[model samples]
Target: MGGQDRESDAWVYVVNSGVLLDDAFASLTLKRKLERGRVSPENLPPSIVGRVAKADGPTVEAALEAAAAAAPVWGAYPLETRLDKVGELLCRRLTERAEEITRILVAEGHPVVLARWQVSGMLECFGPESLGFYRSQMHQEFRHGERRIQVRRCPDGVVCVNPPQNAPLSSALLGVTSIMAGNALVVRAPRSAPLGVMYVLHEVVRPVLEEVGAPPGTLNVVCGDPVPLLSAWVESPHVDDIMYFGSSENGVRFQERCLTAGKKPILELAGNDVVVVWKDADPELAAEALTESFYGSGQLCMIPNQVVVHPDIADALIASLVRQVGHIRPGRPEEEDVLLTPVLRNEKFFGCLRDALDKGAELACGGHAMQADESRDTAGIFLEPTVVVVRGLEGARDIDAVRHETFFPLLPLIVAERAPDEVLLERFVAYVNSNEYGLRNSVWATSSTVVDTFLSQVRSGGLLKINDSHIGFLPYLPTHGGTGLTGGVFGEANYPILRTSHLQGVSISPGSRPREAVFGAWNALLPTKVPTAFPTTFPTKRSQEF
Candidate 1:
């Protein structure tokens, strides 16, 4: 279904609630450049990937209107019913079409493995563990004799999503969680490459929405210039929240706009993640895990941006990492093992490499442009997976490659100066937390003490991995998001279903006067017996003293 056998002018459907509308593609008016490939997609071979309809600002307004109309009815469904009906079905759809969707992601310039990884994350997000956690986080009931008190989450009325072009389908997965929140969703697909996201909404999400007899406007998809759509949403009263994805700097500004408009801003911004390798770590295994830095040419926010190695084993780790990187060469995106993709404009990559070199960093390996076949070529479409070794924690972040988030295949290995293990560990923790951006922090260590030290002391990133793949996603763990610059204001471990909703405390009492309920409810408490609904551990009416 994701293949290019269809005509070049593939039409992307605009779904309003559960109804599919054709001609969502603007005819004759405009068909933008293919957005499938990374960097400058226009520079690549004329792709079989189809053109997107650049819907106008008015279309975005209409989509928002439809979502606003549908949200109340959708949100009224019992949370359990919504999870069982829509969430359950979406999992099945993803499982059935995993291969096809993977291909579409590859076609959109993601490496094959990254594509599969994204698919796996989607499955895990809807897995049994995550669903159970969602139930706990979304709703809880308490009973005291005839009175019932409930604390539950309510869907934000209408959610507007603007997923980054780098990984639209994965980012748009946030919108699916919005659906579970009982919020109606509107997604603005990236105009550069709208095909993958367009495909997912129809084949995966829309059918489930329809099967459940959801409001026709429960979910909507539009592809166009982001400027118009974003401006329209910020000004529109219908948008309750805008899930904007972009650079951290821009996202911080967008956050202000959302606050001014009384709209919640759920941002998935830039990430400068970190990994720590203690002296006791396995060199080969550590090198293998560090390869995640090269995935998607290091474009993704979750990839390990920098690695801090204990000075005692720094040299060995660097050697192993250089060998591992030699195998991660440039090739076609569809290649089973290809990790490198084209970097159409590598000025920033070279600039960072040069700046680090000038500042006394040693080039470990790979700081050049290369052809698809891994041959050195200045004009090649791809850049080698570059690694540089920056010594000492003192002024380590002064280098751009270490300080800023990189969108290319540039990884810096920071080796702190040798010191006593205790002092070194404290310094490492301090250095890690000093990072302005925090999306993830992974540690590779054999000592339980060392791992525990990092776990207890280090306070950076939204998620952490210990002796596991840094970029791998797991059920019950937050799959995306973080703190500091990565998530702008109001940032934490972001679970879309939770982040997009608000909690309300509800209590229902029968045969009670208003004054008694408000002023003397505790004084008029019933017998000191736990309700039948609650188990033995549940609390019962009693004196204030334990």
Candidate 2:
């Protein structure tokens, strides 16, 4: 999924998959440049449209305004009613447009099957699944003699969302949870990945907003330089909360800017996820699971970057991993099973791999960029899954390839000496949980005790998986963020509702009463007048003076 060539036309019409946009299209276009070279005249495949729009500014702003205006009415309606209109509409529209959306995604850079799965998951999350979770959150109860209060979830007004560029559909789903939670949103779509959201908003959300009488500014979408948009939103008095997904370096900078501007920010940042392979782990299963860590060219925040394996099974695991690595083939985005996208396959990734090799890391399997057998212009980005066997953890430490995140297909495998299973497990857990960046962690273990130990000891990541798929997640299970650098303030748990709302405690009384009197009795029991016992001190002082 590489970038599209620049268009030279002033008025560009982005269409859905297989749908060409003529002048008759009803979609809104806020800007029209007329200069001869103002805009590049490029014929972009529909699949790449979703990723390309992340950089459009006017489009995002308009969407945000619409969402903001609609928030009050949406928040005021009964949860069920709101779900029926907005959530249900989103789901239905997504289903109807799934094929087109998936096609667009494939054109942009994803495998068709993966694109379909991405769109399908987004639809399910906005449907009954999300509605049920929100309804459950609405239930209220109180103990005897306690104040009976309705835990009203009020909208937080205007929220700004910055979606990740890699998984455009999934990133939008992460942001949609906040919208479902009653917050009006101004989403900054991945400038490069705008088609998916465009289809969702234009086909699904717009109709719901119009039918349900959502306010004019309830939701908006913009694409452009994220820094300018984020800066403007953070500094704007109208924007109440900001949800961001990006690298830790970028996330930290955003957090600082928000603090400076006196705005609240919820961040989902980067991670160097760690996967541990124990002696008893299934080598075959472990090898299969490792594929997820390399998916999307290892650009995802949850992809495992380093593997710590036990020596007893390390040799076997390496063999299996290398064998499986050979099967990952590079192809066009429309290919049904193509797993990798052709983006960022340049000197930078090659440089990183070369540096790793120079640092004494052994390349166990694949380690080169593959060009498709097609027009050079259409060659897809393909990197061999390069696995590096490190001498030890000490040698791995401080290595940029191991410590930092690189959006490339590079895996570092560290083999540890044989020890008690319990000790090795504890050490592995500690290492994963101790990293400053905590997004996700995966472990391969057959022993229940080892699993339990890992679960208990691992504390950094937002999500933990035991013998299961890493990136495969459900709607109820938040798939976006984590702690520390991962999500500075907003965690990637099923708490989008919380992120989009503020809390306020209220109490009521039937009659006017002295505010201090309510606690006066308890206060009086302490000591109203405690006299210091003199014990004839005055007489003793007088005698001493005499």
Candidate 3:
């Protein structure tokens, strides 16, 4: 009803006072308005707003200055103490506000149930399990002569986080880990998905930041277009590290900018993940796993884009998948198990679907768009759980639909001849290993050997699962990123304790030992220790021995 007028309005949030202010980006309202129905069919949700005032540049600079000034004090905090106070408090607050947060997510187009789970996962990211992971990597000890040397963990100061629009809260969780590692952060949340992030920051993180005596500006969340904020942050000499999530193209560009500015960047970019089903794979299990391949409308970075199935069971697997997919009902955000959000329901996304159909891809099941509710007449961005049987991966011209990360729901199945189980598995492993995107991979196999081979040989993905659950991540697993374009660096496991800090090697010498004492342990184990003395010093002894 208010769609037309709302499309012309924009909301911005900037930091002022000691807390987040709603009118931070008010000036930008004239430049670009926040469109309610422009993306989703919902009304403008309540959130913190920032005004694009020219003088506001100093605010961001001040925030960074505060974070940098506070870094040493925050970084020196005991890991256990920080985990107990800040990490534990954040988790508890999230649990307390779970329902309220889920409703905001639903308002933003995410299904209610899935929204709750998303919050749950965020909470678990700060829980004991994640804390244990940090603890394991925090301290190292080794014996030296009569004393022991200890290696301690250190935090990288002043981290800047730019979360993706698809999963703002979850992506924000990735940034929270920097705090656990004792690094202060400045976060730029997606303008389209600010409500969920604001809710989490206000209800969960703000209190923790205060209670833990975290320095002012240690954790700041600004809501606006990320381009300006990121450019400013990256160019600034104060900002130490930046953690980003977005398209590969943008990621590469961001990396170049950071390098040009002489800054450090950790990018988590796009993915064209693949799933390989061998001849021995069970059809039923493969069907179940297919849900993950298309969940969140296949919008998640780890969601599989292509399925390479053995030709023998390809038909049966497609049939079973079709049946299960049929049960994947699209409904209003209030409905249960309605995972997809009705954003980006435009020609760009649907055009890819149409192009794929025109290119000789056989639709195994869903091919048309569906409405969230018949009465509303306002359609959700729903694409049927499309299963296209292509002769080969090369047959589909809309490869961008399956190859690049399209934040939409589309499933494509590719068939390959069944060969020796070993050879087939090997080929599948090699294909996954060779992929440019390395976020996550799923394999549905009955053979332990097949699973082992995949796990050992598949070098691309950050996480690999066998005959197991997909999409749903545990606290212990690093859920955020991977190698290649996925992050340009390996290891995006969601444990904040690990994500927030860097592995620092510190040697505490009880007494200043000879430099060789550090390398003596290894040298002692060798069959013949390389003589430290120079040839000239041991000339007589060497001559006699020779």
- What TM-score, over all chains together, does every model reach? 0.87, 0.81, 0.83
lDDT digits (tens) for residues 1-546 of candidate 1: 111111222333222210101121332112322222223434332233444555665666777888888899899988766876677888889999999999778766677877898899999998888888898999999996677989999988898889997888988985688889899988888866687888899677888887887887888888777887898899999889898899999999999999999999988899998899999999899999998898878888899999999998998999999999988877767778887766778888898999999998999888989777788999776888989999888888899999989889999999999889999999888988898998999999999999999999887789989999998889889977888999876888889899989999988888755544443544455434433232334364563234
* Backbone clash count, each prediction separately: 8, 52, 22
**Over 4 Å off in model 2, which ranges?**
1-68, 374-381, 489-494, 506-546
lDDT of candidate 2 over 462-502, digit per residue (tens) = 88888877777566666655776777755555366666776
- Output the lDDT of residue 417, model 1: 90
Give the candidate number with the greatest lDDT. Answer: 1
Winning model by TM-score: 1
Worst 10 residues of 2 by lDDT: 1-10
In model 3, where do residues sit more than 4 Å from their true spots? 1-55, 374-381, 393-398, 489-500, 512-519, 522-546
lDDT, residue 541, model 1: 53
List the global CA lDDT of all models.
Answer: 0.81, 0.67, 0.68
Task: Let me know the TM-score candidate 2 reaches against the reference structure.
Answer: 0.81
Q: Against the correct fold, how does model 3 do in TM-score? A: 0.83
